[model samples]
Target: MKIAFPATGTDLSCLLDGRFGRAPRFLVVDSETNSYQTIENDGNADASQGAGIQSAQAVIAAGATAVVSVHFGPKAFQVFEKAGIKTLQADIAPISDLMDKFRQGVLPRMQGPDKAGHAG
Candidate 1:
């Protein structure tokens, strides 16, 4: 599966950006090939309107099947759900370390969709 992570910087050692739309860069990592690509955020402040939805759309456009981040806006979570992309709250560690944690099954799978009115 492929995953996208909103990162604070260009490297995998960077922390995950907490704000989806405002993230400096997005790391698109392919689990199968262990390759990655980075995309910069070009949208302006107006992008904050429906930021979650917009971020989710960007991730999908990057061909991500999962999202690994520190947090996700409620609306963004909904978009992930609709897209059938897995979302997980990231540990407070480097993005590369987090990826390793995921591979090791140390990170827990996110849960919420089962509840009525589930949001981030």
Candidate 2:
């Protein structure tokens, strides 16, 4: 499976960036080969710009089956889910540690709509 993470830096030690739509980096990791690639955001806001959608598209284009991050706006979360990709929201920690936990099945599988989706 391929997983993408919103990252602050290039390496796995980076913290998860909360803004899915405008995260500086999307680290695409392939679980089989353990190879990865980083996709850069084309400079856009988290909510109302094309860049966010494009970034999510790029991750899907790279064959990502899942995304890990601290948070996502409702729109972005819907995009991923609609594309049949799962989203894992959790405490932002080191990417390597997070990946290790995932590989070990220790990290909980995340579900549900974005918090921003709550129509109060």
Candidate 3:
């Protein structure tokens, strides 16, 4: 399974980004192989409108089956739900610890967006 995470940097040692839509990048981890890919979110983050939707689409296009973030905007959460991508929420923490929480089932599955949509 490829799980996506809004991240501060390109690797597991980095912290998870708190703002999902404006995250610098997304770390897509392959649970099976323990390998990961970094998907740049700079372009989406720069969008004055629809940053959440744009980021969601990028994650979907990257083939992410799940998303782990501190919070999600309504539009982005809707897109993920519609696409069957599961979402889990965690407090700001190291990317490695977040993934560990996910694997341990300690992270709560998000039933809806935690934050209101941004100016988009």
Candidate 4:
């Protein structure tokens, strides 16, 4: 499965960024092969509005089967649900550790948006 994590930097060693829309980058990792790709999120990061929607679209385009992040806005949550992508709530941790936890099925799936829309 391909899992996506909001990140502060490009690599797995980087800390997971807590804010989904404002995250600087996204690390999309393939669990079976451990191969990954980094996607810059600068456009959405600085977006005045619709950042969550844009970010969610990016993840879908990146082919992420799941997402691990601190939060998702209501609009973004709906997008993921429609795409059949699962989401998990994770605290700030290294990307590697978060991936491990996800593979072990220890991370909790998010049922709804943790905060309101456009919350930053």
TM-score for every candidate vs. truth?
0.83, 0.82, 0.95, 0.96
lDDT of 4 at 16: 95
How does model 1 fare in lDDT?
0.75
Residue 79 C-alpha lDDT in model 1: 89
lDDT by residue for model 1 (6-97), tens: 88888778887765655777898887677889987767214636655677788888999888876676677788898899887775667888
Off by over 4 Å in 4: none
- Clashes (N, CA, C under 3 Å) per candidate: 0, 0, 0, 0
TM-score of 1: 0.83
lDDT of 3 at 84: 93
**lDDT (Cα, tens digit) per residue for candidate 4, span 1-120:** 899999998888999998998888899999999899998999999998889899999998999999999989898899999999998999999999998998899999899998788653
User: Against the correct fold, how does model 3 do in TM-score?
Assistant: 0.95
Q: Model 2 segments beyond 4 Å from truth?
A: 45-51, 115-120
Please list the C-alpha lDDT of all candidates, in the order they appear: 0.75, 0.75, 0.90, 0.91
Report the C-alpha displacement of residue 19, candidate 1, in angstroms. Answer: 2.4
Per-residue lDDT tens digits of candidate 2, residues 64-86?
99888776666666688789888
Q: Model 3 clash tally?
A: 0
Clashing pairs in 4: none
lDDT: which candidate is best? Answer: 4
